[model samples]
Target: MIDTLLILHLNDSHSRIFPFGPWTNDNKRFYPSVIRFAYITDSLKSLYPKHLFFHAGDYSSGDFPFNTSVGKIDLKILKLLGVSAIALGNHEFDAGPDSLYNALLSENIYLLSANMDTTSHPLKTRIRPYEIFNISSKKICVLGLTTTEFNDINPYQKPIKFKDPIQIAQIYQDTFNNLNCYLKIILSHLGAYVDTLLAKSTNYHLIIGGHSHTRIDTIWKVKNSNNDTTYIVQAYEHFKVVGKILWNLTNNKLIDYKLIDVLNSPNISQYMIDTLNNIKSQIYARFGNVYDDSIKSLDNPISNSPDSIGCLDIPTGNLVADAMRFQTNADFAVIETDVLVYPLYKGKVTSDDIFQVMPYGFDNQNAYNSRIYKITMKGSDMYNVLGFAQLIRGSVPIVQVSG
Candidate 1:
């Protein structure tokens, strides 16, 4: 008898409620709206009834609508799309572990992280290390692993120890083997490089990865210690693509595998559009009525937001510098990349959008004030500043300049 299983995967979606694009050919030009994504996933479910939908993390903390609602909208959207299980990404802890726990409690979605020690965590019982899925009577085990890089970026309220993923994976593999699982899959948010490392160290059959947000069009095959092959795949970020992996098995034995693409799924249902519009209205309701006429009717996109671009020299960075130079009339303006918190979309720019982009606080007050200082500096000192700026690269504290 022949049995088939389909695995649909998403990674690093980053709370993109709506699609914004016309990206360069070198980049993924098309990104579907939330409704479009839901429609496509629902259609896939209809076509392939025995499918498992998994997200490899970083599904939150990019869009203003998702952030303002404290991830409530993101949760609802995921629930609507029918996500099976999700791994913890570094951004999940952006609002702290308590916020993460609370946000998770609102939904019934399964959270997975195999190597994170949750003894001191507030929601220890809620996060499971792994989960088993029975696809067409074939038992498949999925173990989750989050990047230790989360600890470096965000502050957790309690001691959440993250063990070595590779080490812990070996133990999980042994356990799953004893259960007679047909295949072992690792859903990971440890980025592409670490995913490769884990594939080499463990006897798992497939790894669905995120965090680096690279568009990998091909399956990465690596030979494990036992000389068995491990396959890895990651879709491009922000709902640009849905990865569909097909399994062809005969008598519970794997025979072949292939990847299918469901691309440019742009048609959205009226119901989803109405639901998203309601969410957007609520987000706009929270705006403080601070209007800047200069930015109103600004429908032309300066560039894709930093979240979409994922690199420096973005239009948002340049906008910050221009604002500083225009307001302060400084000889030169230099603003750090981190200061621009969100990306600019291709539609009408609103006051709420400005706050999302420039949100920062110190001592319970919004402290992002535009100020100018005049001082005499030696040419050598200015050279040092410029030299230090160049040294900062790749999501570091590089300065954007304008005069």
Candidate 2:
């Protein structure tokens, strides 16, 4: 029997729920909103009932709604969008295993991860290695592989060991081949580099990948040892672009494949628009107003940005350190650039914009109540702290300084 399947894929959408202009420097006027995405996907699914939606990972964090709501809003969006399956991203572990467990408990969608050693974690039984979909009596299997970088990105106190993703993918490919599945797809959060390696190693039909936030507009077709081709696709970051691929299967073999971009389509469903409106209202209620009229006009634009490799220098780091030093009148101040999320936009910068840069603090109820103690450290101790910061340069531990 010959059948067609439309696969809608997205990745590394770091909690950008609100609709905004495109991320790249293009003239595309499409406002990338979750509502728009849902509307488009729903319309397509109506036309193609044999379609599937998959998220490659990094679903939570990076936004106030994600942080404050603890992934509830994202889960709703995923469920509404009819996400068939999702791979775990390193950021999914940002809040530790307990929080991840709570998030998963609320989300009924299939969570696939083959390499994560959750034997000691709460999600051991909940997460499956792979999932099989029988559409039109045709067997379609999907395996998941998350990045090993979770070890570094997660909490130090709670260690979630990760096995080799490439090896796991190979093992699963053999297992699924024995099952005689028509199509085998690997939903991986192992980044593009590792996904490429996996494609070269395995004979899987497709690898939908995430991490590194690379925008691969075109599919990368890699041939395995047997000369069988494996397609790897990643749709940049954010919900600006949805990766669409049509798979034509005949007699249990994929005959033809076409990858296309489904930009923000204008046909928005009223239900989705209402859902988005409710989400916005809930977010505003939860966080309250960010700034008053007085603080709204504090639009002092700062010319500071981290390097392409995410290493911040004087302009970015020093400015933050100077602010800390000025606020507390400390002898010296050191601010880590890792804590800084998005950079200041070129236009007017309000208090809301600055808060978005550094939203996380010790206390969520009172973000400004992060404890700041003035400690009298010995000259040797101070020197050691600065020395340690220097050692972590070019990495997350890299800090900016002021005196």
Best TM-score among the predictions, by candidate number: 2
Per-candidate clashes, comma-separated:
0, 0
Please write out the lDDT profile of model 1 over residues 1-403, one tens digit for every residue. 5566778889988777664443335433245456677777777788877778899988876665555665667878877787888887776665656667777887655579988875766666668888898876778888999888645444442356578889999999999999888878899999999988998888898899998886788778889867988888898687767777776644543444433343555467677778877776776566443322226545565642443534556577788788878887777777766556556555556554565464432111212222345566776887798787777664453767776
Highest lDDT against the true fold, candidate = 2
Q: List clashing residue pairs in candidate 1.
A: none
lDDT of each: 0.70, 0.71
- Candidate 2 residue pairs in backbone clash: none
Q: What TM-score does each of the candidates earn?
A: 0.78, 0.82
Model 2 worst lDDT window (10 residues): 290-299
lDDT by residue for model 2 (120-192), tens: 7667766789999988777889998888865654452156778988888889888998998888999999999
Q: Which 10-residue span in candidate 1 carries the lowest summed lDDT?
A: 361-370
For model 1, how many clashes? 0
Model 1 global lDDT (CA atoms, 0 to 1)? 0.70
